[model samples]
Target: MSSFARHRPAQPSLASVGPNKLTQQSLAKRLLFHSHPTDELPPIFLSETLPPELTAEVYDFIALALRAYINPWWTKITRYDKEFLPQVTHILVIVIRALELRIQRLNIPALVFHDIPTILSQHYADYRNALSKLSTSYASGGAASLPQLFSQMQPHTAILPDGKIDPEYFRQVFDYILRVCLPLEDHEAEAERIIVREVIVKVLLDDVLPKVTQPWFVQKTILDLLGPPAEGEYMGPLSAPPSSFSFHNLLIIILSVLQSFSGACIALIHAYKQAIITIKLVQHSPPYKSSTLPPQTGHTGPPPASPVADQSHTFVSPSSISTTTSTSSSTSSHPLQQWGSISAEPLTITQVGGNYAAPGLAMVSEVFSTRDRFSSNIFHIMLTMLSISITSFLDKLLPYLLLNTLCPAFILNITRLSKRTLFPNGYPGPQPQEPTLEEKAEIRARLVAWRGEGVLSYFLPLILGPRPSETLGAAVDPLSSAQCNTHLLVLLLDRVLMGLFPELADGLGNPSNS
Candidate 1:
């Protein structure tokens, strides 16, 4: 070799460097050449370490990120990204769950703007604009034209051949929910989909209904929803072949929808209670009740000098006269001046009588309305919501809870479940015989007690057997009423379907048997 070539330094190969380059010593040496280790390490997320002053903005950012991740409307992100779904679910669980905790740790209000995210400001603005437009329509064209806004959305579409269902009227209900009521971000979140519904409901009860004042708006929407689908829609394939939709198809969906409304109902009931209290207070107050009394002499202005008495009037000592005049003026204003000083003066009997003719009549009218119209409307909405929640036990929820979520999960993972749960209280061995009326009554009573004791007390013992008494039974606390009402609604569907064929099923078996 030439002396010049031999003088060149040898370059290092991959084998010479070895696979341990990531070791601390080598990594430090590599990193030292470029930058400090702290600088090289991933920059601590700036947002995670933010100061308290920017907490609201942090929440906004999180909500926005959640919206992006969820793509609630399917417009923000594509649904084709199946692998990303789990990530979204976990993120949503964090938002739905961990967000409050994080906020608390940061020392921020747990409920900001009533838990309405700043990211939804645009959406709310749109909602307000739409509401205004709908209000205008109601005012101009009347209540009959109110549905015009929603009607713009293509009328319910049925899946021509197989989708024709009777009692399966979720097309409208689901539309109201997805399009209007509670539009969720994730599809799999149908089980937990409640945020939008709650928002819509609060707006409807507190904001929309109270201010709207249109009777038709309330009446039509309530009747339309609570009753059945109207004509020309969901009648199915307008042709020679006869077909009809059954309510059974959408029974679970409707019950779920109603169950979601329970919060709104509770709010309404609270308001109703407050209203009753207020009305009672008003009735007891001077405004609601009327009484008449004889006019009394005025203390001011020399008792309005009469023509005969004017000549006979005599002026006494200046000190005595002046003292009496000051006393009279101090005690009351003159009646002649009372007209101009109506606001300052105590209302007179004549004034009260005049008010009775006008405003009192109004109070009377309101009192009459409270007895029936107000109660009926309030109860109708409340009972409707309550019924939905109450009946959920018989619907699809119980069976699914028994068969899918709880039972299968336990039986598959925990081998000891069957012995403790089955055989004794539920299922297998003893064939269930049809009960007589007296036995059925006792069964009903027992079920009612279970409900009163709370869902956990009721369900755990049934699922885990008497062992649950050892753990969850000590002073049984009730589960959330809203949660309890959300049981699957499929079971009641059978009864509904059977009831539809009352000609055959009218008295075949007791309705309680369901």
Candidate 2:
């Protein structure tokens, strides 16, 4: 070898480095650096089991990186980073999930319950503040619309390469944010918690829904969030399949949204009614009466505990109570359990009963059965919302009543579901097993309970309440307002009754003729 060549230092080769000596550290940074494609997720994200250590590092890095993008005080990032956000969001979903799993496996409920939500709340506050600023700018004509304003204000985290908002991305975001926001236990200040919830409602209502270009995509997203309609499968009354979002969650969210609403109740109702109808179509059943557990014949264990003696305070069903306990346990064990584990046990009969029930029955309202505490809560909130809008804000109700096509398709679905419920054998298909006497009795009880506790308990009085104009007694002309409000109330009553009793033909006109 030549003297010059021999003088050069020997370089390390694969064999010289030795496999054991070579460190495989921080795979996330390496993966994120090289993978810039927006169309698909990086390999680390696609892996069934992600590296926990690396994932935690990636999550921290992402949280830091996203701070600049979501920060309210700094307007430094004005333009969207289209390529980075979509890919980063994919990584985020995976990394957040992996970190959640790791935290769970380590049996750290505090991190999952408190830290995650508080951290996420802080992030959401930043976003909300920035969004508020953006909204002000938009009002002054800074952008063409809300969608455009958001796209310009922050990196398009939910936007695709084709420059369209990806509904799935927002769904994941909503699911994650919502999962953390649940659990009635107060982890953060009340204001912070409210901010987090309001952000979700605003994004979904003000930003995502209106921007979606696809025809049915908005409706589909809403339905999925509210628990997709139950297929004609045989599910136990207590069976609640795990989902990313659920009807129970939706009710809580709607109630939260209402806290922020001044007069947007009609818009909120219009947005959710279809999803609610679809959910009720198949899930509708009578409220379950509390019964004593049958004594076990072959058991040598302590007898099952009796129901709580405080009949004045209605408790959620046993299954729901169990679900809350299970959720707490599962939060420390399973990652998927975090998404849709919230149950209705937190709701009390007094909270939802309001002043609608008779004075005598009001105190014993809990004695009656409800289809489910969550479903009952949904009706109560909806009734309150409708009442508020009709009596408090006639203008909002009248416009929605005239402009929207609320019932044509839903009425058809109502008829079909009614047929199935009233006459299961009427349709041509495999025969369903006839319900037992106990089942039939339970159904009758539910119907009676619904009559007393359902929307009709409040709604009939509201619709028939001294015409809305008289209730408001505002400067608006009473004659014109009365006519419009009455018309709107009747229409709303018709729709509400359809949901309450699918078999009822003339909802307001005649209850007995059907």
Q: Write the per-residue lDDT of candidate 2 for residues 1-514, one digit (tens) a residue.
A: 7997989998888888855358653323333433432222234333344343444444334433333233332235544333343344343454344334333222222222322232222222323343465546544654444334323433333444334445554344333333332323332234334333444445443433343422133223333444423343224467767878779999998988887584467667875997576445424432212111111111112221322122211111121112322222222221212322123221111101112212212111122211124444455456556655554233223223322332334434554444344334432224334457676444333322221233334653332233322322211111122222222222222222221122122211222321
Model 1 is weakest, by summed lDDT over 10 consecutive residues, at 107-116
Which residue pairs of candidate 2 clash? 287-370, 287-371
**Residue 148 CA displacement from its true place in model 1, Å:** 25
With candidate 1 superimposed using the best TM-score fit, by how many Å does residue 169's alpha carbon deviate from the native?
Answer: 51
CA RMSD (A), model 1: 31.1
Task: Give all candidates' CA lDDT scores.
Answer: 0.29, 0.33
Q: Stretches of candidate 1 above 4 Å error? A: 1-5, 18-34, 37-102, 106-109, 112-380, 383-514
Please provide TM-scores, in order, for all candidate models, with all chains considered together: 0.16, 0.19
Question: Which lDDT tens digits does candidate 1 get at residues 190-245?
Answer: 43344433433443333332322332232233334344333433256756666466
